[model samples]
Target: MTELNISTTAGVFDATAAGPAEGRPVLLLHGFPQTRLAWDRQITALAAHGYRVVAPDQRGYSPGARPERPDDYRISLLVDDVLAITEELGWTTFDLVGHDWGGAVAWWTADAHPGRIRTLTVVSTPHPGALADALRTDEDQRARSHYMLDWRETPKTENDMLADGADSLRALYAGKVPQASADAYIRQLSQPGALTAALNWYRSGRPRHAIGTIDVPTLYIWSTDDAAFGPAAAQGTEQWVNAPYRFEALRGISHWIPEEAPETLNRLLIEHLQTHEEH
Candidate 1:
């Protein structure tokens, strides 16, 4: 993969591109505490299959892409960053695949500008409306999401996450991310202001018009053992996509779907991309 410093309306963004540059472009957005390298496995395979994969480090994670204010990291702004990057790449329409927080951004993008997205595949995140509803009415979801409040609403949350040499982060990736990948993330967040900027995603309230129906060929993939989301939220995602939708549930997989089950995730994504090939 080659690194790219892309200029967008928000600011300069750090991105990684792989596969044949001449092939159909597929924008891959990664979630929190992760860099574009998270898609390493999928990148090579997709590229071999005749697709160009572009993965951005995203708002807070990319040193050059970090915004100054917490409000700047809001979901709307994050969505705009994706749009700006795609436009900067001269892509009028392309396939989009996002994981975790990246999935959240992709959901918003597909809903707000359906024509710009030929197909969408989201992993390990529910549609915004489904997440919101679950957060409001489901006690289990609320309980599980306590970390969001701690990171977003509480004052010392950022400090706490970095305390004791980022022990919390270490624990979160203990069994998931490879040691090399985990080390890279730890080093990146160790930089001044990076972790705080990342945490800001939770600090802001949901984007004003976050909840909307996505009108494009869509695929939602969920792992049964993901700690952050439950069956209710995952199943409810159907109501928000007004187009052809496919939902796949993987048993025994964790939230780190791409890393934990790369082959499986790749197969699902390839199938979705091929089935919804642009005209």
Candidate 2:
């Protein structure tokens, strides 16, 4: 894997590039409180499979890319960060993969730049519209998402996440990610201003307008143990895709699908990419 510092309009983002340069490009985006390191397992797998994988320490997560203002972390700008990374790589179009908050940005990216994404693979996050609907009408979803509200409303969210030697943060990935992987995430977010920037993603609030149907061939994966998202939203995702779509549900896995279940994730990703390989 090659670690690179990519310059974008926002700032320089730290990223990792792997696989043969001439291979099909695949852009991977990670979620809140974690850097591109979150893709460690899958990146190696995809690269070995001959996919050019580019995973970025998305805006706010990278020190140079961190913007102080909460608005800077809005959905559009988050999507722009992905676009800028792809542009920097000279990829006009690529297979897209995202997890957690990264999955949210991936959804908006596919919606806004339909032609630029050849295939969309979202892990553990549902379509914005489906999530919004769940938040608005489903009591269970509302309860499940209480952490988001706390992150948005409480000024101490950062401290709370970092206190007790980041015990709170460690709990998030209990059985989901190995200790080393969880430690890596904690170390990144534990940096000064890192936790704040990550929290800004939540403080930025939901998208003003819903991200609608994606036209590209898409794959959505969800684990039954995810605490933040529930079954209703996951099941409701089918309604938002206008093209070929496949859904895979992992009965016992947790929200940290990429880390907890890399083999399964890689198999699904490889199949999805091959099935929709651009001729």
Candidate 3:
């Protein structure tokens, strides 16, 4: 893999990329507390399959892109960052894959720029409207998402997560990700202002624009053991997607699908990408 510094409106983003220059372009976005490394396995798999893969450490996670204001991490800006990176890469259209918080941003990007995104794949995060409704009316979803409250608490959340050498943050993987992999993620987040910038994604409240229907071909992957995103929201995700959509549930898998279930995710991604091959 080649390390790259991608310039965006917010700042230069740190990214890792692979595959041939002439291959089909694919953009992978990582979620909270993790860097572009989260897509390492898929990057290798997809690149080998002849797809140009690029994974960017979004917004606050990249040292150069870290903005101090909580509001700067809003979803709209986050979406803009992805578009900017792709535009800089000279990809007029590309396949997009995102996990956790990244999935949320991907949803918004696909909705806002339908013609620019060829195919959309989201892992472990439901559509914004599905999630918003569940968070408001579903007790189970609200209970599972209670951690968002703590994450929005600024210094307190950072202190608690950083305490005992970020043991709390490491626990998030729940034994699904290998120790070395988890360690890499923790180290990146341990950097000064890194953790807070990641949490800012949560503090930036959901905007009404995020509730629209996605018109591009889409795929939603959810694991049964995900602690934060519940099935109720996953089931309702289709309601917000007006385009062709497929939902896959990984039974007995944890939230860290990219690491723990890379093979399955890769296969699904290849199938999705092939089905909607850029013609």
Candidate 4:
């Protein structure tokens, strides 16, 4: 894979890219606390299959794109960045995939611009509306998401994550992610203002980013053991999709689905992408 700096209307974003330039375009967005490295396995696998893949260090995660004010990290702006990045890549329409926080952005983008998204694949995170529904109706889900409260306390979280050599931050991976990849994530987030900027994703704007049902052919992958989400959230996700939709539950997997279950996730992703072509 080759590293690249992609210029968008917002700013230059550091990205990891691969595959033939003429191949079908695929844009992958990484979640918080991680960089474009999160998609390493998928990038190589997809490039071999003749699909051009690019995963950007979205928003606050990229040094060149990080903005100081929390308001700059709004979901509308994040979605704008995605649209702008695709425009910069010369893709009129493309397959989109996202994980964790990235998945939230993906859901909103596909909903807001279904005509431009040939397909949607999201891992580990449910649609924001579904999550909101669960948080209100499902006590278990609300309890699970309580850590988001701590994340909003940026000063405390930064200190807790940085103190003791960022033991708390490293523990987020729970040893599920590869050591090298996890180390790279820790190093990037440990940089000055990086952790706060990353946390801004949680603190940005209001409760939900997505407003309507999505019509794009969609795939939602949820792991049974995901601590931050529950069955209630996953069950409601399909209802938010107005078009062809598939929901897969990995019985023993965790929230870090891409890292912990790359092979499974990749197989599902490739099949979904193949099932839906850019038009």
Candidate 5:
């Protein structure tokens, strides 16, 4: 993989790319507490399949890209950052895939700027509307998402997560994320201002938005055992997608769907991309 620094309206974003320079571009966005390296496996596989994959340490995660004000990390700004990076790379339109918080951003980007996205694949996150609905009506979802309250209200959420050598953060990924990857995530979150900036994603705006229907072909992957989201939220996602959509529930899997099931995720993504092309 080649490391790159792309200029965006917010700042310079650290990115990684692979595959032929002229191949179809696929932008992969990572979730909270994780870096672009989270997509390392899929990046290699997709590149081998003739895709030019670009993964960026988005917004707050990238040292130079992080903003001081919480408002700067709003979803609109996050979407703009992705578009700016894509424009910087001369890609007017590209396929998008995101996991966790990245998935939320991807959904918003595809919905608000349909012209910039050709296809969308999201892992382990529900559509905004679905999330909003769940947060309001689903007691289980609200209970599961209790951590968000702490993240938003507590002043020391970051320090507490990082203290004790990030033992709590590491535990969240136990049995799901590989040891090396988990350590890398902890190290990234440990960086000065990194965790705070990331948490800003949750704090910058309303916790959820009314579900907006997306017109682009899309795929939603949810694990049966994801702790952060409940089945109601996952199943209700289809209501907000007006375009062709596929929902896959990986039984017995945890929230780390891409990492825990890389091959399955890669196959699904490749199939969706190829099927979209054929259609």
Candidate 6:
């Protein structure tokens, strides 16, 4: 795999690129508090399968792309970064994959620009609308998502996340994230203004409404043990996609699906990508 600084009108994003240049283009987005390295395992696998993949550090995570204002971290702007990065890469239509917060942005992007997305693969995050529905009806999801509210309300979210050699932050990876990977993530976010910039994603309040139906072929994977999203959200996601859709639930896997379950994740991702031809 190769690391690159991709420059767009909005900003320069640090990303990891793999596979052949002439191969099918696939853009991957990482979630909060993690960098493109979160997709390292999948990146190598996808590249070996001849899919050109780019996983950007994303808006807040990329030093050059980090913006201070919470409003700047809105989903719309994050979607903008996805499109801009693809445009810079000269991709007319590409497969899209995202995890966690990245999955949220992926849903919005596919909904807003289905023509540009050939296929969509998301891990752990359901459609915004489906999740909204679940949040309203499912107490389990609400209880699981309490941290989002707590992060936004607490004045020292950053201090707490970064204190004591970032023990609090380090603890987030107890769900089997490789110690080396977690250490790198902590070091990246521990940079000046980086943790706050990443936290701004939580600070940017949810959209008052849900995202529209996504028309592209979509594959949604959720681990049963995920603390953030419950069965209500995962099962509700099928109704949000108007095209060929598939959902897989991994038993006992945590919120960190990609890292905890790379073999399964990679197999599912490869199958999903192979089943759909690029538009």
List model 3 lDDT by residue over 6-74, tens digit each.
987689999999999999999999998788888999999999999999999899888999999888987
Per-residue C-alpha lDDT of model 6 across residues 180-265, encoded as one tens digit per residue = 89989999998999988888899887775568998999999999988788999999999999899999999999989889999999
Off by over 4 Å in 6: none
Among all windows of ten consecutive residues in candidate 1, which has the lowest summed lDDT? 152-161
Superposed on all Cα atoms, the candidates' RMSDs to the truth, in angstroms, are 1.3, 1.1, 1.1, 1.2, 1.4, 1.2
TM-score each candidate.
Answer: 0.96, 0.98, 0.97, 0.97, 0.97, 0.97
Clashing pairs in 5: 129-211
The global C-alpha lDDT for each of the candidates, from Candidate 1 onward, is 0.87, 0.90, 0.91, 0.90, 0.90, 0.91
Model 3: lDDT of residue 182:
89
The pairs that clash in candidate 6 are none
Off by over 4 Å in 2: none
Tell me the TM-score of model 1. Answer: 0.96
How far is 104's C-alpha from truth in model 6 (Å)?
0.2
lDDT at position 110, candidate 3? 90
For residues 196-241, could you state the per-residue lDDT of candidate 2 as single tens digits?
8898988986677767788989999999998889999999999999
Clashing residue pair totals per candidate (backbone < 3 A): 0, 0, 0, 0, 1, 0
- Per residue, candidate 5 scores C-alpha lDDT tens digits across 186-237 of 8888888888888998889763455379999999999999999999999999
Q: Give per-residue CA lDDT, model 1, range 30-139, as digits (tens).
A: 99878888899999889989998899899989887888677898887888888899999989989999999999999999988888999999999999899888888898
- Tell me the tens digit of each residue's lDDT in model 4 across 22-133: 9999999999778889899999889999999999999999898999888899899999999999998899989999999999999989978888998999998998889999
